[model samples]
Structures are given as structure tokens and as C-alpha cells.
Target: MATCAAPSESDAPGHPDRSRDDRWAASGAQLRALVDAFRSEPVTPARTLQFEHDVQIVVRELGRQVVPFRYNQVEPAAAVDQPRHARFEHETYTRVHAKTRQNVWTVFGQLVVRRIGDRPSQAGEPMLFPRAHRLGLVHGASPALAARACQLLAAAGANQQQILARLRADHGVGWGVKKWRPVSRAVSDEMGVYRHDAQVDQLRTWLAAAGASTGRHKPVVCVGRDGITLRLRMKRGSLYEVASTSTVRVYDRRGTRLGTVYLAYAPEPGRPAMRGALTAVIRDVLTRWEGPVPRWCDVTDTGDNETGYDDRVLRRMTHPRTGAALAWVRVVDYYHASERVWALANMLFGDNARAVGWAKTMLTWLLLPGGVNRVLHSAAAFRAARTLTRVQKKEYDRAYAYLRNRMSHIDYATYRRVGVPLGSGGTEAACKTVFIQRLKLRGMRWAKDGAQTILNLRVVFLSGIWDVVYGRVLAARPQPIMGGHVAAEPNELEIAA
Candidate 1:
């Protein structure tokens, strides 16, 4: 067996390269011992866990050993264009430390990166490490670890405290909010670059699948949207704001939903961002469909926000190739329609059993052919029989108007027969699951940026496109210059050290 008699660096807070070779040898020894011990011992739960822990320790050490070799490959000597003495370059920078030490958090453990770094002469400028950027080491964590952190933080009901605890216990990574928050946010920002393209690709794939699906009816694409209330941090003038979410799904001719893609945005006065994005996504998929035009529809509740978006965006959309207006079938959520019925019933019967029976009959009537008109007629009969107080009369009129205004869109009977979804249940659930489920936990109030980061990640994740989107985003950024990190977002600047 290969032996490790070299001194250990375990006592030091940061591992130095002088003893990294020794640690690499020790890690190999540890791995061999671990396997041998596990094989010699009888299988047991405790023994298995011990083996796993031991493996993690040795593997982490091995990962740390990789940092130097990876940077060594980037050293200028191998380059035909640059002189061997020129280390890592950023713009015109050639003066760099032979070995610049950096501490980075990894899934395995904290790995210290000894890389070639350039020091900009400008005052107040941070040191730049080209190798770190190539390896996607930014915001104090490597890409692998950052992806894990983002996923855990974006998970429903996930908080920094819970994620930190998990990281400490399982991955041996001890990161506090100071480190974790920035890393998670940085990854979320990175995702913004490729998330839309990934979503569009996935949507096209689903639409193609639907077009090819064989059944009695043509394939259908249904779009739904809704909103939920969010609690903002105290600094914001209004402590509460409305957040919106949209879901687009492909339905086979059999009326089975094939797949769904979700998009969301933080609270905006009119949700213009979300609406524009939703419009583009739908248009892209529709234009890409090589088969017959699918039955496209907007299925949502009749909230002003929801209907206004439909009227302004969906109704006005046109085919990219031909410029012909794209018409969308309208559908008022059946559940929301039913709720309005109960509102009127309660106003008439004052929560009596008669109201319950009457609401049930009206909903049942709503499923038949020409049901909306029938329900309106039945409502008129009830109003004629009762002597309502002014308050009851006023509230009843409001409830009645809710149904009346959406009467044209509430064609539940034809929609059901043709396999069109009459309910916006998916979008309603997204309002809760995408936004409220994660951000509305007790004592949680968010700054717009923090909440938006989570929503951006959550939308892609819940849409079943996490790997596709995240993998591209986390992959190394295109080689911009010889060294240094990718340029920061427009407003934010980063001087990588």
C-alpha cells in the first residue's frame, strides 16, 4: 500500500500548498484504508454511515488537490501567443502573483485555491484571478456547490437557517448567511442569462410532442395566470404587494396534460415583465409547431389583472411569420365561476341550506349546453321571489355582475366536450406553490431582489427544466479575456479577489 508519512495541515484554518501534496497522499491512504476496513467489517447501519463519512473526508481532500493542477493548465507557458513569463492576463495585465491563495466553499468541503492572480495598480481595486473565473469560482463558492445552495434555498419552505444546518451536517460545509446569501443570489442572477432560452426549447419540445400525439381531437395548449399577496420588507412603503405566476401546458387530444412550463415575477404594478415574457414564450412555441394549428386558449379567473393581461397581450399577439392575428379561446376558471355562484346564493339565502342547494343546482346547470344563460335566468327568478334589503341588493348585484361580465368566457359545456381545460387550477396552485409556499413562511419578509432571485429560480425548477437551465448557466462563461471574471451585471460591479 502507498503510505502517507508527511505532516498534516488539519490544524490550520487554511490549507497551504506547501503541504497539499502530502494531503493528496494522505487522502489516497485514507481511501484505501476506508475500503479495506469496510470490506473486513460485517455490514451494519452504523458501519455503513461511518464508511460514507470517511469517504467524504478523503474525497474532499482530493478535490482540494485538483485546484493547483487545474490552474497549472492555464499557466501562460502552454499558450503559443503569449510569452511564458506572462501569467494570467486581464485586458493588458501581465504582472501576477505566482500563487494567489483563495478559499472557496465546495460540496465536498472548503477548498483553498492557489491560483495565478493579477493585481490591478488602481487604488481600491480588488485582485483578479483568471483561473477562478475559468473554474466558475465566484461569490465564495464553486459552481457545483453554488448550484446545490441555490436549489436548497429555492426549495419550498426553505430558509437560510435550514439550508445551513443541512450543509453543516451532510456536506461538511459551514457557510453562514453572509456567504450563502450572496452565492445563492449570484447563481440566481447567472440563471437569468439562459433560463428563457431553455424554457423556450422545452416548450417547443412539448408542443411537438402534443402535435404528434394521436387521439380523437387536435392537440391543445392552455395558458393560465393568477396572483398571490406577498409580504415585503419594512423599507418598502407598502408592506404587502401582489406577485404573479403563469403556467403554460400542452394537452394531448385525449385531454391529458403532457407537461407544463412556469414563469413568475416579483411584485410589479402591472406585471408588464411577466406578461411580455408569457407572450413571447407562447408565440415561440406556436411558431415552431410544424403540425396543424393547435387549439390555443387562455384559462384563468376573471380578475382585472388576469383579464387585462389577456386582453392586452394574448388577444393582440400575432403570428411571427404571417403577421396574422393570433386568436385565443377564452375560458373563465370553472371553480372561480362556481365561487361567484355561491356568493350570489349566500346573499339571497343568508347561509341557509336553501342557498347551498340553490348553488349546487346552479353549478350543475352550468355544465349543460347553454348553461350560463340558464344560470342567469335562475338567478333572476330568485331575485323576484325575495324582498332584499338595500345592502343585500347591492352585494347581490356585484356578485351577479361578476358572472355576467364573464358570461361569454364561461362556456364550460363546449370546453369540456372538446377537452379544453375549464379551470385555472394549475395557475392557482402555482400562485400558492411558486410564490406563497416559499416566501410566505412565518416571519419571512423579503427585499425585492432576494424574493425575485428565489422566484426566478423557482419558476424554472417547478417547470421541470432545472437541469437544462441550470447546467447551461453554471457551465463556464465564454472566454472573454485571458483572465478575470465575467463582466458583472450592468449596475453591479465585481472586482474578484
Candidate 2:
């Protein structure tokens, strides 16, 4: 098989780098021969096999020729400890034995990177190929390949095996699931770091802008918060229910969703941590708003878990650095409230013809002017008129408590007039899109870290900030450097495959 070779220092006089040109020309010639052979074969199963084989050969040769050119461009020149005509005496690089590292697979073919450096005991020891670090090239795959693998995983929602198949079929890159998994994890981990840094920068910029504002009137901002349960595999072989929160932001009109953010905890975060995560989401929204700080509205369901969300979470949010309170009016989701009313109606009327009729009338009153007052009056009258059974009384009491507890949040008429949203549908949909669609796939079980990392990528992609976030991620990665002593090679890097 054809293999890539680095450019040698020795060259014949007056020859115009014939070695490099000849390698390129030879690869080209072989590619042409493969094409010819493929075309000459008849349309049989054997012929199809021959064509595939020929294509692989051509790609291998092309990769062999191209890798060297790229490597040489960024490879450091031979080290010069001292020279007679040197301008400075600070030069310290010295030539040493070059060792062959593991081969990395790419779309083209297997790529061999030779590590050039000093002896183990030398001062500047174990010099590496600078281009490799610049490109984030790993022992098993190049950065480009790793990134491509991650993109596929994110976009296709494919498992490791499926991703490997798609890559080989679509891009001509071949690697097993074991190789792809770590690359995916590494890229996702980098993404997590990028997300944190981006949020910090955003907060700083928002603080600066807030400080400069002249306190002009701004439009109201509507935020919807909700949680979705994710099934996670426990280390002890049972399933665990983890709650992930989703937040959605919309402008004054609530017609177009501005953005959505998700906080997914695999092993389940504590209440304080969950609250902090939620606070971060609100902060992100404030940072992205163009106008001055606006009135805030939070629409959420009235489930037991979400009952105190307003007081416990939203009310507690403040500017991390400035300590300014972020106050928002809490609104119970209209649909959730309506569902309770429907249940009350069913309990009161049973299979009577008036059940649906009463439910519709109650729903209309709940949404009309003086709705909560009218609904409360009607409930009181109904309770006084009926000598209910114990079960019936219990249901009625429960329904009354639900409405009374959220009475402040049930003012649909005022909310409608003010253009505030009354539903948490945006948050619910966001939960489905950001987490359920990808992470909750069939037979999928994730480690805590792995799930969180993947969630980071999914959020960035769904929020339409993948490109920006990914660029930042690449920038945030520490540039690989040569170490003083001989670095211990990873098991995968020990052999060229």
C-alpha cells in the first residue's frame, strides 16, 4: 500500500524538489490506472468489488502524497544549538532521533505523523510536530475527523455503530465505535467548557451595557419554565428519574420565541444547584435583550413540584455580580388550571349531560373579566348547595385548594390584556427538543458526565449558536506542546493501524 513520507533535507543539485513532485505524480498515475481498471470491468458483483477496491487504493495514494506536504509546512526546521553565522545565541533546538507515532485515520486514509525531537535527557527534550498540535491532531484521528464525527452524532442522533457506518459510507472515513466514542466525548467536554466561558463573557458584556443604560422604558419579557423527567441508568443497575429544566424566552408580544436554554442533570442535582442553574438561564436572557432591563413574567404549571417555583427560584434570582433582584410575576399555566376545572366538573356532575356544558361555562368564566372572583363565588355556592359524599367532598376540596393557592397567578384577563403569555408550552416543547429527542433514545443509557456533555452540544445546536459556540470551543482548547521527558504513549498510539 502507498504511504506518505516526509520531505528529506538531502536534494540533488538543480532538481526543483523532484522527490516531492515524483511522489505526487506517481500517486496521480496510480489513481488513473485504478480508474481505468474499474471502467474496463463488466457490471458484475466481482466488478463492483473491484471498483470499490480501486477507489480505496486511489484515496490511499492521494492521502499519502498530501499528508507530507501539510506536515512539512508546520514542522519546525532542524534545531541549531550554535552556528558561526547566527545572529543570536539564544537558539537551543537540536536535531534528535525521530520516532514514528500512531497512524490517524481521515477521509483520505491512514495518516502517519513522525515525532521529531531531542534525546530524553536533553534540555529541550521530546520535540513534537507543531502542525499536529495546531490542528488538534490526536493519535487515532485528526481534529477535522473528530469534529466531523461529533457533528454527525449531534445532527443524526445516531449511536456509535451507526455513526461509524455513516462516516465510512458518506465520507470514506473508517473507524470502530471504540475510537469514535472518546473523540465524541472529548469534543463534547470541550463544548461544555466553551459554554461556561461564553456565558461568563455574556454576563460581563450585559453588566457593562446595563451600567451604561439611561433607564429608558423597555418592553416586557416573558419567560416560561418547566421540567421534564429523563430516565437514566444507575450504576447499581436500576433506572433513575432525573429532572431537567427548560427555560424559554420571548419578547413583549410573545409571538416569536427568542431562545431556549436547558439545564440537564444526569444523577439529579440538589435543589440549590437546580435553582442556580435556572438563575443562570434568566441571566442569559437578560444579557441578550437589546433594550434596558424589562418587566419579567414567568409562566409555569401548578404541579406540586412547580408550586413554589416562583417564590423559591425566580424571586431568588439576582445579578451574580451586582446583586440586583430579578423580579417576575408568576402565572400558572392556563391549560393546567383548565384541566383542574375540568376534573372538578367531572367530579360534580359525573356522567350527567351537564358535565361538559358546566366545564365549558366554567372555563369561559375563568378567562373572563373578574374571572377568579366569579369562579370562587360559583365554587362556594356549589359547595353550600350539595351534601356531598366523603370522596366527592375530598375532590371538591382539592380542586378549591388548587384554584385558591394560585389565585394570584390565575388572572387570565389581566395577563391577556398585557400581552403576557399564560402557557408554559414553549418550555415544554424546548424540553422535548433539547433533551428528549436525542438523549432519550431507545435502549440508551448514559453516564452522568456523558449525558451532560451531550446535552451541552444539543443545546448549542438547537439554539442556533452551534457555529459560534464550536469556534469558541476550538479556541478554548489548550494547544498541545512538546514535553521535556519522553512522553508515555497511550496504548492506542503504541501501534500504527
Candidate 3:
């Protein structure tokens, strides 16, 4: 590296030639004396013109050694000038990355003209990439070449630190550094499409802005669910099926209603497990229920197997604020598709765990017309239908009256028009959509906290401020660039370093 220089004067000791002017002055008198002495030298007879005649005669006897010089003589040749073709010069280039190249014959032409016409003249065509045929610069997908290109682009678009961070944090992106010879080399785009800090920042900013906008709004009534499921690993010492819970939150926004998140933890219709887990799920459903307030809540066991009792179910009543017995019962098959059975069980047990016995009533119910079945004794229409067989509809007479009695008070038909809570399925769907979509990858073995973080992200996503909330959370994290400054919007300038 060059350093600042201090001003100084030249210094030489005992120099033979101090300067050209000094040497010339000192040699002038000597040159003159030598010239005069040489001019006064002898004009000897031995070196006179008389010696040349004998030498000329001797040369005639010996052949002269003439050089074989071959050169074209420039004869004007009487100026018979014929027309010559115009001399044109051109060059071509071959390249692999042709997308980044262009042929510009006009550019070359314009450049030549510009160079020749330093004197101002505008009587030529404007410069451009013309449609004339020429050589192309090709660019191949060599890994090294691509990497170099990426580096160049990155240097132009972003910075070194940004490029490095993307390589480390974002495996999806195509870029990183590798060792070359004795030194480390940065290879851009060596990876795939990795997330850049700018993109992440932009998303975070958008979310923050959205959150700030909606923070003032009232909390819309959101019904959510949480469920648990168990997995058994038979190979490494077998284990029993454990019950896992997933919680879902359902809400309405504008006109669009979302069902569930794709590939998320959801409560299945008939997965068998301990009754305690079921009770917890039912309890959550009751707590989160928002629409169509019911007089009483009910819990029932609806699984395939009954390895355990169902007494653990808990129900809460609203009007009189009272707690009732957690019901339990035995069933031939706990998994029944009948909505009436479900309704009856809910009404009778009122969130009690003991409603399992009603499965017997399900088996005895008579199939009615119009795809709806009613109990022979409970619903009177089936009893009054005389065309039905006596043995088939044993309690047909009582069934119609019972149906009329319930229908008169319940107005079950009108329930369809109004938005009312039917079951906790909405919240259950929420669990499947929001939680499982993010956490459950095919081979992912997540620690509790990692799973929770994903779940938290899911919640924020569903909560309508995922982008904003994630930014806030990421801002708090020391792993990413962090600061106490209020979260920035997408268009906000970067914080000063």
C-alpha cells in the first residue's frame, strides 16, 4: 500500500554526470579539439582513390555476394487505379449465458463513427442494438460461474453480511461460502431460493402495521378447540395409544368463512382413548362456545372401545349455575351417526359423562321416511303410520306424539337459518387447520418448545396478525437482528446500525 509522501529535494554525491547541460558544456571544448585534430589528419596516398581501380578490377574477377532480398517495389505504375472492394472488419463471441448478452452492430458502428468524428457531426444513425447478424456471448451453467454471477448480483443488490445471513438461516436459498485453495470463497446462489432478510423484514413490517390497525377492534367471539392424541412405538418397546389434544379457534370475518387449516391437528370423530382426555376436550368446547346459547351443555363418550369408564365428563349449566353428575354408561358401539341420538344424549345428560348408556336407545330406533329415523316410542309419527309393520314399528303410536311435542317447542327447522352452535366441530376444525398445518411435517420430530413455537405462530396466523406478531416475537429474539424500537412497517427505512 502506498503511503503519504513528504516533500524533499534530490541529493547525489560524487556523480559522474550532474546534469545533461553540465556534461554537454564540459565536453564541448574537447569535441571541438577532437574535430579539429581529426580534420588535420593525413590524407594518405595508400588510402587515396588510386587504390579503388585495382579493387574494382579484382571485384569483377570475384562474384559479389548479393543478399536474396525479396520486397515488392512500390511503383506508381502510371496511376492505373482500379476499383477495390470496401474493407470490412468484424469479430464474433460464443457464450453460454446468452440471456444476459446482446448483439449491437449499430453500437459498434456508432462507436467507430464517434471515435472518428470528434469534430461535432450529427448526421449519423442513433446508436442501438441492431438486428444485424453477429457472434453471440454464451454462458453455461457451470456451478462456479453461476456462483460468481450470483456474487456480482448480490454485491450490486445487497451487502456481504446480508448474503451470509441468508446462506446460514435460509437453507432454501441458493448461496453460501466455501473454501477455495487456502482462502474462503463466497458462492452466491449455491443453495436454492432462501429467504432474504429483506423479505422477512418486509413480511414482519406488514404484519406489524396490520396489527396496529386492528388492535383497537373488539375481540370477535371465537370458538376454539384443543385435543390430544397419542402415538405408540412398537419397535422400540411397544407402548399404548396416548390421547393428544389439539385446540382450534373459529371466528367469522367479513363474508368469507374458513373451515380448517390444511394438515393440522384435529379431533377425529371416533378415536378411542382414556375418558379423561375426552372430558378435557368437552370442557374446552363448553368454555369456548359462542353462538346459540344453550340452556344446558352435555358431554358424552363417542369412541369405538370402552377400556375405561366415561364418568370423567363434566358439564356446566348457565341459568342456575349448578354442577351435575359426570355421567358414565356402557355401550355396544359408542360411535353412532344419529344426530337425534346425540341431541337426546346431550339433553338428558346435560354435559354429564354418563350418557353412554343411550347407545341402546340408538339400536332400537325405527327408520322413518325421508331419510330421517325417529324412536318408535319417542316419535309418534312412526307409530301413526299404519302401513308400517307391527313388529317393525312396535312403539309407532307414541313416536309421532313425541316428535310433535319436541318439534313444537324446539322449532328445530328454524335453527338452520340462524347461526347457532351445533357441535364443537368448528373449534375442532380450527385445531386441524391452524396447529397441525404448521407443526406436523412428515418426518419432523419436534421438541415441546419447537412445536409450541409453531403452534404459537399458527395462533398468530389465525389471530389475524401473524405477520405483525411474528415480527414482534422475532424482534425480541436475539438470534435475529433485535431492537426495542417499535416494529416498523414494510416501507419504513432500515434502523441505523
Best by lDDT: 1
Candidate 3's C-alpha runs over 4 A off are 1-418, 434-450, 474-497
Per-residue lDDT tens digits for candidate 2, residues 86-183, read 11122234435444444656656555555444333336545434334555665456766776777777763576678777777645666776677677
The TM-score measured for candidate 2 stands at 0.74
Candidate scoring better on TM-score of 1 and 3: 1
Q: Model 3 — which ten-residue stretch has the worst lDDT? A: 64-73
Residue range 438-473, candidate 3, lDDT tens digits: 333343344332333233333333434433433342
lDDT tens digits, residue span 1-497, model 1: 11222211232333335455676778788889889999996999999987887787677557655543343334432223222222233334454535545676766666554455555555566765655676677676777778887788778987769888888765667777788777777778888767778888887787778777778877888899888889888754548888888998889888888888888888898898888888888877767766677888999988898878888778888877678887689999899889889988988888999999999999999999989889889998989999999999998998789888888898899898888998888888888889777998888888888889998888878888889887887564653354244333312321111
lDDT of 1: 0.75
- Superposed by TM-score, candidate 1 places the C-alpha of residue 116 at a distance from the truth, in angstroms, of 1.4
Which portions of model 1 show Cα errors greater than 4 Å?
Answer: 1-48, 66-90, 119-126, 236-238, 480-497
Global local distance difference test of model 3: 0.29
Q: Is candidate 1 or 2 superior in lDDT?
A: 1
lDDT score, residue 274, model 3? 21
Q: Provide TM-scores for the models.
A: 0.85, 0.74, 0.28
Q: Alpha carbon lDDT of residue 188, candidate 3?
A: 15
Looking at model 3, residue 105 earns an lDDT score of 15
- Ranked by lDDT, top first: 1, 2, 3
